[model samples]
Target: MQSQQLWTVRWLNAIGDVDREQWDKLALPLSTPLLEWQWLHDLEASGSISPRYGWQPYHLTLWDHEELIGAAPFYLKSHSGGEFVFDHWLAQLASEYGIDYYPKLVGMSPATPSVGYRFLMAEGVDKQVLFRNMLSAIDNSCQQQQLSGCHFNFIDELWFAQFPAHDFASWKHQSYLWKNQDFEVFEDYLQTFKSSQRRNIIRERRSMSKQGITIRPLNGQEIGTDMAALMYRYYLNTNERFGPWAARFLNGDFFTRLFQNYRHRLLIIAAYTDSAAPPIALSMLLVKDGHLIGRYWGAETQVKDLHFNMCFYAPIEWAINNNIKTFDPGAGSPHKIARGFRAVANTSLHRLYDPRLKILFEQIIDQANDMESANIKALNQQLPFAKNTRPV
Candidate 1:
């Protein structure tokens, strides 16, 4: 009998060294282009998430004698933007108590909230040892650099299941997720809702269509320079609409490389003005196999029901047309429930240094998860669905 032996921590400048095949090998959940080597590298290459913008990539990797064991996307964040969870209160508490919160470690897929975050490790390795060592590395770095605790947001249920004993707290959040049961057509989808809500969604689409706004679901290859440029404009406009976190992640070049490298996984659905098909609103999503992910969307002009048509209806139609399975419209907005997205549990894992803070956040999040589960049940009951016709 013996210990698995000593481990070493390393940093990856390029995702190439991280072995995509191995990542896929250890991967338990569905992968996205955003989490892939090419996409993450493009983000760094195109200056999306970098130290220059306060997101220093300090990706910690654990190797058990030269074989990659555990790794997580660790970023030294100056500010929180792409992170969907709001932690200003924690930061403010840190500030009010004269503590520094910036430069905290974040374990998440940057600029995207498609959950499935965990420190990917091989099966033979001791999960506890692997995570402890990984956390040990980050803790040392935090102490040396005078930073705050780690925040792991938007992860999966499996990771959450195994984290509590490690003093890691669970953060609960509700997001939109549509299941593709036996649905084969758009009408089949409409059949789930009560007639009134169904009529509203139908009328919403009709109004946008009658307004002469045509939505074209374009793949990355089919995306022209004009539409790409318009997307950036919309990104800018959306940023203004929201405030801080809305700032663009990648400058235009990232998208340029994006459109070039991983064109197949992308679906840019564009809505345009009739004068010459100039786009007014658009959505950018990643499509894999039979799943259509709702990524980013924005409009140049504020048209009524435009967001509904372009973001939800258009993609759902495409999903039905292609027979795609699940549609994960990215996190936020409870309004998504009425639009056909169901209550789905999204998970994330965390580790903290101060035992008191660890206990506090743990209790807080445990209570929160309980409350959220109950609330979602209540929300489900309120959905406009005929008796026994609900899509659960």
Candidate 2:
């Protein structure tokens, strides 16, 4: 590891503290849209992830003399809400050991469960050296602040591989992902499924036509402020249906800002009663580099098969047409399985400052990981695809 004195580490309360160009230099190269400067800044500016909501931004950045070299988007979290990786059990374990779990350091794009997190580094720097120094900075900062040890969730596989050397324990989770297998068309995709599932999908799609509903995907130049506002209403309506269990993290302002500033990355699938009327259902997605992430969706009224149409079938068809390689329908819903989403492993890394809690984590983490792995395997086995057609 290089000497820590070679780099100066500073913590900022907001992403706006850094220049947009400088931040994007590192972020723009990433595959996921959530890590981009505009997304993180809007999350903070929109009050969706403020300190009052238990997410206090404490982003760590590194510099070498006058050059901005590396940074990790971090937070001082007071509770576990918004983070898809469930760690409430960890909090309970801390309580059992008479330790405090709140106010721990976390690193990820807020509220986003997709991976692709790592220290952003400039060219010509030894990545390992910079990573080691950054890890030191995180450790020192956590100790100085008397916070629980840090966690990096949904991290890129390359970065995840590096953490074990630094003693961060790995925790496994799962998410549904649809991977394109050189499919030339939507029908080609259906062919991979069993004959029964293929017929079922056809029936579900036929329902849209029977109900006189049309789904349209609008992107880039097609998105407008009015459409963005309508999408926000659908987003809210979806959450309201769930009542208190809704993870209504983003607000109307965030939606407005997203459409205004980042519409190029947005894809809205609008389901209308017909071409003459407004959309009754909408699903908002982010697309970049042949990957699509289904973020939010809602419907003003419950239409039979509307959720499946707007959320899965329509998006998958559009993704196939656009040559998208992957579609990550954001967390939850076993229904995605029958529709072709496969349960894939997702991981998070952790380190606890309390020795007793750390020991407890070590003792139980392997068993927990085993259970999750088995669950994923079992879920995949139940998928509607033919055994030979399943991903290896």
Scored by lDDT, the top model is: 2
In model 2, which regions exceed 4 Å deviation?
Answer: 1-6, 162-164, 387-392
Task: Write down the lDDT of every candidate, Cα atoms only.
Answer: 0.75, 0.88
Q: Model 2 Cα displacement at 24 (Å)?
A: 0.5
Per-residue lDDT tens digits for candidate 1, residues 1-392, read 12555777887754555776655555434554455566677778788878888778777777767576777777888987778777776667666666667878887778788876667777777787777777778778777776768888787667656745555666677676887767778898898888999999999989976887778888856877556667777767776887754546767777777777777788888887774757888788898867778877788878999888878888988888888888999866777888888877776666665555555566677777898788878777677776767445
Model 2 TM: 0.96
**lDDT of candidate 2 at residue 333, scale 0 to 100:** 76
TM-score of each: 0.86, 0.96
User: What overall lDDT, based on C-alpha atoms, would model 1 receive against the true structure?
Assistant: 0.75
138-199 per-residue lDDT for model 2 (tens digits): 99988988887799889887755764577889899988899998888999899999999999
